[model samples]
Target: MQDKPVLKVVNLRKQYGSGCDHCDDGHEVTWEKNSCPECGTVYACNDVSFELYPGEILGVVGESGSGKSTMMKCLYFDNEVTSGEAYISSYNNGETNVFEESSQQLRHIRNTILGMIYQNPVLGLKMDFSSIGNIAEKMIAAGNRNVEYMENRSKALLKHVHIPISRIKDEPRKFSGGMQQRVQIAKALSNEPPILLLDEVTTGLDLSVQASVLDLIKTIRQELGISMIVVSHDLAVIRMLADRTIVMLDGKIIEQGLTDQILENPQHEYTQQLVYSLI
Candidate 1:
């Protein structure tokens, strides 16, 4: 039997601004219509949906403004959802729609269940704090009060991400860009979350650095059996990390399939162009 998905999302929508003439009529608004011709309204995400199974890596690929990041933000509770349901099997027995949860509950979920690595290291790491402190913060938030345990966990995770344990007390600002990213990865995994959300983790890095980070992610997945949703505009990143892929256009999923199938034989016109452009 196929393994049940660890996370499920349905008809997820996030919009900015009040109802417009088009929205008033209950007509579907395309992403291209950012500002309604009749009345201004921004549609950042509309009718997005997907599932992520345990130990599976789902790649969300699209150019800028395609709402890939917006969707992830909603999932991470960094942005609020306008409508739709998101369920995590490990949370509340998957009965509660995460979007409807109270802020406190959401905070608990974000702290304990979901791990996120931002494209910008500054956003993910506390530059003022030592690398160990950054990781310890997550552990502390999860109710882990044992100082020794937190320190050991942080050191082990740092080592796992290829950061030297000797630098445990060093500030993130002192690290290289790639190393800072590695530190963020270690912090995200500190709680041993069942799901990890990686947003353009390889962007703005040297080619060699990108490869090393990707290799680290692959190793983590193989060793820990973690489920991940990797978001990127770079097809190469998606191809390297994802088992299955979803192509988004104008805030909507236009195509989805196995990574190799989507890369080798794209079905949608936009996907075909995206694949060919990378060749």
Candidate 2:
């Protein structure tokens, strides 16, 4: 329950290239055919850095091609970082640089110390399984194959997420997109991770639904005392959810400050453009 900054990212960089996926390192490859091999590889994230304090909401806002999503992926270890480091502080307030962690330790961190919520709720869940089934599956995986403990933990998580105990038995196909999104949140929380990464959690929801979801996230974060990193294109959402906002363009951070300060008095030309566009 240490309350200092829980996660710190410094000088992080991620690049995509022709032979990158085939690099001898142990990165899982997810490159596409259209990904350029001839042209010099693009830098998805370049020297982006930030810190998330315990129980704080740090929002990242940028255009679609901005490195917001890439940065989040790096923090969660979904994507291999080309350079730089992210530090994860432990429950006892001990800090370990993620880049220096062993594979086994990294896996433990991913399962027990960090959680991620993606832009698309559907993309994050197992559509083939029911909501409860998906939760059970992930709990087992995160707990490293403890099926009995997973079953109990999954039920407890569903209860915590405010899912009706009755509806916990139903499949995702029976629920609306908002309900599905709540289920995803519950699954992510099953591990009781110290840090949570949210990538456009409001992506496809309407204004009213989005507001409710964001409010729920805020409530949960405060109640659990967890640090969060949220990336979204919506400045309004950023203003509502983030204690601080980081602005990015062309794979670089243009500015970062308290949300109110950035909103009230943007200094950078890019920041002004973004603010004006919002207006």
Candidate 3:
């Protein structure tokens, strides 16, 4: 492990409504789950925090409405945090808080630093654009303008994701679900980012396709050595892809540990149910 983390998040919180004294920080009033029954304030993510080491895949597994996706979105700058700070080792020597950057700086960070692969292909891919075009588009966003270089680079990325050369010019909308995801993966890697955030990347794929995509993810991490944070509800997916895992419930991290350790010796009741259900 490196002495410094590539990404670190501290006390991250995302809420949907203005809170009363009951749901404010350090308030004693509590609710059954994510929402404050009295105030109707939903804590989509509540004081969640974690770190991603260089070349490591950190998995976050949680059921729907568990705040895993919200956290990923916050990290990707898709959603603003209610309060907290995040530091990237490559950006400002990890001294600057990402949540506080300007909109222009945030765009620069998205283009050159962090890559996001959304659960929905529609969210990540330009379905009407050619697969290669989609990849090239990301590079262009990152300020690459040489036509020849972009074409070659796009081809290489699509090839890396196992997209056939014949279909390089085909639009993502015309491709099958699995192929669309492969193209999305290629697009996310177009900028050669140091950190990639995968939000439920395999949720809708067939079992066989899911396995292949999972294999490609593992191969990409090993070959590129890029750090990643994978969010999923599937413990099986996390087990296959993550070096370390965190279990989230009700907008909080209830447990986290090595993937194997969590699988073999889960501590929290929710985590235990999740692991045993795999059997």
Candidate with top TM-score is 3
TM-score of each: 0.96, 0.85, 0.98
lDDT of 3 by residue, 62-149 (tens): 9999999999999999999999999999999999999999999999999899989889999998889999999888889889999999
- By summed lDDT, which 10 consecutive residues of candidate 1 come out lowest? 29-38
By summed lDDT, the worst window of 10 consecutive residues in model 3 runs over 23-32
Query: Per-residue lDDT for 122 in model 1?
Result: 92
2 against 3, candidate with superior TM-score: 3
- Give a tens-digit lDDT track for model 1, residues 1-279: 137789999999888878676775768665344445556666678788889999999999999988999999999999999899999999988888989999999989989999999999998899999999999999999899999999889889988888886788999999999999999999999999999999999999999999999999999999999999999999999999999999998778999989999999999999999999998
lDDT of 3: 0.93
- Model 1 off-target regions past 4 Å? 24-35
Candidate 2: residue pairs that collide: none
* Count of clashes, each model: 0, 0, 0
Pull out the clashing pairs in model 1.
none
Query: Model 3 off-target regions past 4 Å?
Result: none
Residue 113 shift from truth in candidate 2, angstroms:
0.5
Worst 10 residues of 2 by lDDT: 29-38
Top-scoring candidate (lDDT): 3
Model 1 quality (TM-score): 0.96
